[model samples]
Target: MEEMKRVLKETVDRLFQEMNGRFVRLNEIDEKFGFLLDLKGLIYDEKDYDLKKKCNELGQFYVSDIDGNELDE
Candidate 1:
């Protein structure tokens, strides 16, 4: 798990180094991470995750599109 996290951080840093990753606020990062976890995609880490009533927990805050793009607010 630590290795996975390290790889992810390295990937983000490398990508930002390659281009522009603007300075987003901490609250915005929280919102974006929440958006990612709450995203309903064609693939699921757990097959029965939907049956667990998780999205209901997310409520109005989970509004990103499948591609993780923010829709009009």
Candidate 2:
């Protein structure tokens, strides 16, 4: 009976550790996705002419369409 109790405890502890690791990774991914969505919305609000000029000056490339695709200038 004592050995059985020890085995059960070890199993539960391993399962809890695995779950904690997954939860932490998921939180990190959610934060990154939220930041990208905000940035895309801000860029969409600007006028096309202004965006183009800014891109040229900054030497960075960006898609003017609704899609948020960026390329290296």
Candidate 3:
């Protein structure tokens, strides 16, 4: 488990470093982190997660889109 966490961290860090040279938007980063956080919560059993409950909390500052691009404002 520790090794998996280490590898995941390293992979994410490497991706971030690689993307540092590109033109990335701030909200795009936020959306990506939000997706990651949601997965992390599920993995760590932060609570009894469900689709309906999560959907209700969506955009209320909890989970965001899982695999969608951020819309233009």
Candidate 4:
């Protein structure tokens, strides 16, 4: 169980980093923030995995092109 958790955590961490990088690159394009990358609120369920159990949230990523002050048009 411990080993599974550790591996899961590592996988989640790597996924978050990759997602963040992709979001950043997309944001760099001057094409008016077409879509928002909001993976920070992702919910993971262990039941969905091979192990029919429950695990806590492993990681999160939140990278966006638009700012809070920006208006949606």
Candidate 5:
């Protein structure tokens, strides 16, 4: 009976260790994915700002052209 108890305890301990390792791995994956998402967001924001600036410049050029101002100089 004592030997059976020892074997059961060892099995439980091994299972717990495996589960803990898996949990740690999953947490690491989550952290990495979060970082990637933040980077993607930042890139998109920069692109949006660049597009907005271009649009504004184009609008100014159109207005200046209508006023007979030289745009190429």
Candidate 6:
């Protein structure tokens, strides 16, 4: 029982470490693609958009794709 518990603990620890490593890489990818790049507000910055869909819209890149590319008119 003690050995089984030790093995389980080790396995859990390894899994957690692996998850942490993946998260670090995920952060890098997010930065590369501007995903969650700015956590200050709920939305992204205005400059990221190509056009302003609404007059009251705050951000420029309000309408964009997965890669942050603005939509064409």
The lDDT for every candidate, in the order shown, is 0.50, 0.55, 0.54, 0.43, 0.58, 0.52
Poorly placed runs, candidate 2 (over 4 Å):
35-73
Alpha-carbon error at 26 in model 4, in Å?
0.2
Q: Tell me the TM-score of model 4.
A: 0.41
Clashing pairs in 5: none
TM-score of each: 0.27, 0.47, 0.30, 0.41, 0.46, 0.49
lDDT of 6 by residue, 1-73 (tens): 9999999999999999999999999886664444333443325445654233332232333334322233211
Candidate with maximal TM-score: 6
- After TM-score superposition, the amount by which residue 35's alpha carbon in candidate 3 deviates from its true location, in angstroms, is 35
lDDT of 4 at 57: 14
- Stretches > 4 Å off in candidate 1: 21-73
Candidate 1, residues 5-60, lDDT tens digits: the string is: 99999999998965554445555666544544555632454575442233443444
Name model 5 segments beyond 4 Å from true: 34-73
Please state every model's RMSD to the true fold in angstroms.
13.5, 8.8, 14.4, 18.1, 17.1, 8.7
Q: Residue-wise lDDT of candidate 5 within 7-67, one digit each (tens)?
A: 9999999999999999999997664334334555445665444434433454465665432
- In model 5, state the lDDT of residue 19: 100
Model 1: residue 51 alpha-carbon error in angstroms:
64
TM-score of 5: 0.46
| lDDT-best of 4 and 5 | 5
Error of model 4, residue 29, in angstroms: 1.7
C-alpha lDDT of candidate 4 relative to the true structure: 0.43
For residues 1-73, write the lDDT of model 3, one tens digit per residue: 9999999999999999878745356666655345446766656655564534443444344435431223211
